[model samples]
Target: MGINLQKGQRISLKKEAPKLEQLMCGLGWDVAKKKGGFLSGLFTTDFDLDASVLCLNQDGKIKSNSEIVFFGNLRHYSDAINHMGDNLTGAGDGDDEQILVKLPLIPQNIHKLVFVVNIYNALERSQDFSQVENAFVRLVNLSNNQEIARYTLSGNGYQGKTGMIMAEIARVGDDWEMMAKGEGFQVKSLGDVMKLYS
Candidate 1:
């Protein structure tokens, strides 16, 4: 078990799990179940939530498309981050997707790694965070598979939103820190969120 983080809470990875060289970021979400709506029992909604990592430089901006790792680009140029493919449907249990990070291999210029999730083809699918539930991001120490911390969110607060800025792992001096953002955005896709850093 690990600390159940609250939104905006930040923790020092170095202090929590010393000698943490490798990390696994696991993200999960569930589709909202229809409640007593007409025809609700006849159809089940499918969700394709994408988890991405935006590697920002010291100036808090993205310099190239290579810095963003997602289903399309699984590995970072520096080999510090790797996204574990895409999960088309938010089905089954446990983490729907995972991203592996090698702390020591991170590039010197990269100061922050922002974790984000967006509905795939949100505009076309007419889907939003309002149809999602039990969204969470958690950090695990890969060495022993121990959970370091977790941040969870309920979709009830993100009505009409299409994307979410979940959390961030930031470099602070010689240590790494993790912060739970849990901020929802109206952006349509991951590319729209990338524009924020560009």
Candidate 2:
């Protein structure tokens, strides 16, 4: 298992877990089965949440569009980061979506990577984090399949938010540190949120 990180906490994967060179970051969430007040019957909600990665250069600015990996772009050109795929319904026990990264292979120009989760057509569907439960983001050592760290992104702080900036992997010198950023934003979807970093 892994330690659940608190917001703003930083974990140096390279220094703390030297064996963990490559890792798979998994993002998971669940939509509550809505219960009608009068009928009291349960209804399943289809939420198309996308997990995206934004690679920023040394100056913290997105250098190129290819630096991003998401549903549209499953992998980066350098093959440093690969997004498994999109989980349309958010219906899974462990990781609804996964992004694999070879820490050592990330180019020197890329200084930081931001993991973002945004709802598809959020405003039109009237969807937000308030309806999500057990939302979490975790990192697992791909070589050993052992969890390194996990962070919960649900609760009062996430309610009514359309997007969540789960965590950031920052490169400092020769070390990579994972910073928990369980912060929310009001963007309609991933495209809008990408502007903040781009």
Candidate 3:
């Protein structure tokens, strides 16, 4: 078992799972289905939410665009990190999107991995996290399939924000630490996020 992390809480991955090497960061959410009369079905539809990862160095910065892993680019150049794939509708019960990282294989220069979620073309669609219910990001120890830490995201605070900064895994020497961010931003695409991290 692992800790259920609250907003702003952080945990040492190494302390919880000393033998941890490979990690799986899973993100899940539900597309709100508005209830109405017979016409309700017309308005209820799946909204596309994208999960992305920004790889940063020891100083929390990316050296190149190749450090970003997203639907368009699923894997990092070094093959240390990978995005399992994109989940557009958030229809699954478990993880909608997954990013796997070979912690031990990560180069010494890379020190931080930032996980983010954004609505696909939210600016044009006028959609935000407000319509996303039961959003969550969790880190698991792939070796034993035990969750290391989980952060549940609420939509209340994301009123006008189209994107969210889910969590971060920081490299501390040979160990790793997880932090719950849950911060919302105005960006609409992964490219916008790279501008901030790169």
Candidate 4:
């Protein structure tokens, strides 16, 4: 079992799981079913949300596009991080998408891994996090398959926002710390999200 992390709360990975080497960051969400006429279900459209990670250097900056792990770019050059794939509909019970992290494989220069999610073609689809429910990001010890921590995003706070900064795993001394961010932004695509750090 893992603690349910509140926004801005952080936990030490090393303390919780001493021998932790690899981690699975799982993100899940469901579309809020529309309350409408009998034909609402028939007219519903699947929402596509993309999970991404920005590998930041010691100075908390992204130097190259290769440092980013996403659906299009499944794995990082250092092989420290790998995006499982994209989840088109978010129509599952568990994680819609997963990102694997090999802590030991992470380069010394890489100090942080930021996990984010942005709606694909948000503007064109007329969608935002406001229509999302049960959005959460969780970290699990890959070695033992035990959850370490989880952060649940409040849907109401994300109205009019298409992008969300879910959480971050940052190197701290000889260990790693995970922080729940749950910050929302009005961005159109991953390119726009990248600009925030560029």
TM-score of 4: 0.97
How far out, in Å, is residue 34 in model 4? Answer: 0.6
lDDT of 2 at 189: 64
Task: Pick out the ten consecutive residues of candidate 2 with the lowest summed lDDT.
Answer: 36-45
TM-score of each: 0.97, 0.94, 0.94, 0.97
lDDT of 1: 0.93
Q: What is the C-alpha lDDT of each candidate?
A: 0.93, 0.87, 0.87, 0.94
Q: Judging by TM-score against the true structure, name the best candidate.
A: 4
RMSD of 1: 1.1
Worst 10 residues of 1 by lDDT: 152-161
- Candidate 2: lDDT of 93? 97
Ordering by TM-score? 4, 1, 3, 2
- Tens digit of per-residue lDDT, candidate 2, span 9-85: 99999866786778999999998667668554444458888999999998888987898999999999989999998
* Tens-digit lDDT string for candidate 3 (80-131): 8999998878897999999998988887888898999999989888788887
Clashing pairs in 1: none
Model 4 bad stretches (over 4 Å): none
